[model samples]
Every structure is written in C-alpha cells, then in structure tokens.
Target: MRKGILIFTLISFLLLNTPVLAQEPLNNIDLQPFLKLTMNVTLVNTGEYPKFIAVNPTYDFKTFREGDEYLLHNTTDLIQLSKANLILNKRVGFWIYPHEVLKVEFSINIPMDLGELYLQDYADLCYPDYTITWSTKRITYPPSLGVGPLCEVVYPHLINYPILVDLTSFIQVRDPEIVIYSYSGEVEFTITNRGPKTMFAVALPLIPVDAKIYSITPNPDMNYTEYMGKFLPTYLKSQVQNAKFNLTQESVLFEYTDTLLSTMSSQQNLIQNSITTNEDIVDYPIWIVVLGENSSFDIKYKFQWEFTR
Candidate 1:
C-alpha cells in the first residue's frame, strides 16, 4: 500500500511540470496569392573588383522566408574574362521575399576592371528546379490577378526549356519593338565582333507545334544550322483504354507516342491532337521549352520567325 501511494505521487508530480500546445510557436503566415523572385548580395571586396559577371537583368524582385536557398543558373555569356580564367563561388539572389528588389553577382578568377567588362556576350540565364522555404511567419505580399496568357508550351516534354516568359502575342502589348519577319524563304543575319573574336554563331532553335513539316521558310537574313532534317511532327498524348477503372488515378500521369503521323486511327477527320484539352484542367500549368544551338562560340542574333500556325 505504501509503495503504490509513492509511485502515484511521482507520476502526478511529472504531469504538473509538463506543458501542452498552449505555448507552442504559432504559424501566422499570410501567403500571397502570387509568386515573386528576390535577391540580396554582400560584396566581400567592394572597389577591389571593377566589373564582374551577373545573371539577371535589373528590376527583378522577391520575398522569401528566412533560411531559403535558391538554385541560380550561371550564364556563360554574362562573363567576359580570359578564356583560361574560370568563375568560382558565384551567387545569385540571396533569398526571395515579398517586396524586395534583388541584385545578382558572381565570384570570378580574374578580378578585372568593371569598365573593361561587356555584358552583351553573356548567354541566356538557365536554371533547374529550386526550393524556397518560409522560416519566419509574417510575410507580406500583395495579390496580383492578371489575365491568362494566350500561347501554349510548344516543346515536347523531353526537350522543353524556357528562356523567355511572355508570349509572342503578348509582345505586341509593348511599343517600339522590332518586327520579326520569319515567314520568308531565308533569313540573312550578320554577326559582329563587338567585344570578343568570332567563336560561334548563336540562333534560337524553333520548336514545332506538331512534329511534321512540309517546308521551312527561313527569314531573309543569313543565320544557319547544319544538321537540318526535314521537319517532322512528334506525338504526345495521355493514352487511355476504352475502359473504366477504380484506381486509374495512380497509373495515368500521361502517355505519349513518337509517331504523330496523319494516318487515321478512325474514319473521322484529322483533328490536331490537343494535349491540354481535358475538362478537368480548369487552370492548366504553364510549360515553356527552348531549343538552342550547341556551340563553344559567342553569338547574338535578331532573327524573325514566320510559321503557318
């Protein structure tokens, strides 16, 4: 009887000292409906280096919660160093947060004069997947709801990357832009040695809407590629059987075929395959794919595109 009373007393004493969810950290996060990018930099050597490589154009902004690390795409054209010298420890945008303008930077092997630097040689900024975590709870961002864009991601899933975001139709929303005449038979272009010697010709590869092509009418300018095959259409479709299933959700991400030829599977009209026409996808995700040349040279271009859309 004495032992039982002693054990009960000890258990009651332990329970009294423990605290519950009443004192737990509260999560007061008011996530904005829109997403933005931001960056911050602390230069170790201020005036020591005159000019260095950078990634993004000015006027990019973001708001990230504390302890977020973003993966930045290191652009080759942004650096104008000696061919032998390499870049090291280059960092872009500190952490994106709401209402913060971001600047980008890179660590270089040759800390040369900034005036001797030329940013025109830098290639497009490319990046893979990145993550952002909200460490602090109170983040303020205004919601922005705009009209949906008109263009679709034209690249096949395997070869899709986006260097530009705004749609071709959307470009008309601006003024004083150069008119790109692409529908001509040949495009004549002249590349110049602005800062560096001629190493390679740069041109943006075009992704076809459907895989097959009857002809390619290049612009009147002279930018060219060597391995040009007769244009052909590639096939992509989320294939499905004419049956029902209880657990089809787990299996059907999407299926596609390579041969999108015009051969009829049925006696119906040859309807252009619509990939994102599902009734379920009320708000479809945006995908962009960019095809570029593989070269070890510096090139810039202003080419026009004309296609029978």
Candidate 2:
C-alpha cells in the first residue's frame, strides 16, 4: 500500500512539474498621433511560466532616406520590468512573469541637416511613409523535460508600425535666382531659405560638365563632384587590339592588318551610334551645393560647349 502511495505521489509530482507548450506572446505597437516621433510598445506574456523576452527594433525607410542610424533614438524605457538589458543591434531584453504586461517607450530625434528634398517630397503628396519593425522572441523557462532539445524553446513574432511625419511647421526653401553670362559661359545661382526652423547642409543639384566651381556668399562646408561614363565592350576590345599590335607589319600580315583596321573602324562607328541613340549612356557630372537655413548664398561656375558646322 505504501509503495502504491509513493508511486502515485511521484506521478503527481512529475505531471505538475512538466513544462507545457504555449503560443507566442501578444505584442502591440502604438505611435502617438500628436507627437512628432514618439512610439509605445506593449508586450504581454500569456503563458503560465516565466518568460525571457527580447525585442529588436528596426526602421524601414520606404520613401524617406535609408541608412540614417542617427535618426533613431537608442534609449528605451521598459516600464514593468525593473531591469532592462541593452543587447546587440539596438535590442532590449528583460524577464517577465506570467500574465505580466511590459510597456516600452521610444523617442526619435530629427536632425537639422535633414535636407529639403525630404520635406518637398512630403509636400508634393508623395508621402514619405516609414515603418518600424519589432522582432520579438519569448523563451519559456522552468526548463523543458529531461533529455529534451538543448536549445531554449522560443516563440517568435513580428510587429510592424507605420511612422507619421508632419512637415507643415518645417523649414521652407524659396525658389533660387540664376544668372547666365553668354560670353564667358559663367553662371551664378542664388538660393534663399525662409524658415521658422534652422536648416543645415542642404544639397542642390547642378547640371553642368567640366565646371570651375566656387561658393560666393556663405562659404560651404565641402564641394563634391563625380563623373560617370559608359564604355562599350567593342570599344574596349578595339583598344586592346590596338595596344597589342605593332606598327611594322610584314607583307604576309598586310591583308590581315587591313581587315583588322576595317573591323576597328566599324566597331568605332557602332560605339558612336550606340552612344548617340541611348540618352542614358551619355556621361553625366554631379555637383552638390550645401546651404544653411534662413540664409542666402551664391554659387558661381563656368562651363562651355562647342559646336561644329
């Protein structure tokens, strides 16, 4: 009888201590409509056991600029969990008991140098929609049953929140004034910013080639220039053949030489025609003009083109 009682007690203890499988935790993301860049996230552990939860937040810049890490605020507050762990890749983790709710608040800061293009894109009804993704995982503890999988049992889930941007009170850029000198091929461009907020490091595109550039009114931080070209495979092959061949050719090789020259000439014509027919293949030069807010500056440059009769 005692043996039966002992066996029954052991069975009851095993059944009570066994870990039960549970579904993923419930998570909610909220972005304050009135605030500029504020977000709140709530997480609830619905399981019966304690869970170690980790959250990783990421930004998806759909229309606005990408790879701007400086725009996201790092510091996050975990309201329920008295302790917060700052993990890798802007992740936050904490421990929560059964039926407990955790709240996290995030605040993002907008820099002064966020260019005029972003605002203009938004104003044109081109709404720069941005989304934030929360990657979360919960590991239930009280350690799984014996000889089970060594890895922790984790339930993973993802939550997405769309960010709202209001640029009505943002800085405004006025139309620029341009002057051209026909004789010297020199041009002057003036830009003005009328603003309630200060702007910095604004970039304006200049469409000209082989230009002599200067910043006249307020000196710019830096000037950036780049030249892009498209080279055809046939042109490259002709160049290689020309480089490999010698000027002195024996009579036996003369016929072959004439054919090679004819081929090269045909290839050159093909390359020229290809360039002329495709507008996208033409070489382009990019120049960036940097400016400040509530201010004006003049940019002077000389560029010329020649025509054949």
How do all models score by TM-score?
A: 0.17, 0.20
lDDT of 1 at 137: 32
**In candidate 1, what residue range of length 10 has the lowest lDDT sum?**
26-35
Alpha-carbon lDDT, every model: 0.23, 0.25
> Candidate 2 on 43-153: residue-level lDDT in tens?
445567765444323211111112222123223322222222333344444444576554434332222111211212111111123222323333233332344345322
Q: What residue runs in model 1 are displaced by over 4 Å at the alpha carbon? A: 1-166, 170-173, 180-256, 259-309
Q: What does candidate 1's lDDT look like per residue over 252-292, in tens digits? A: 11111232212122344443332221122111112221223
Candidate 1 lDDT score relative to the true structure: 0.23
Per-residue lDDT of 300 in model 1:
18
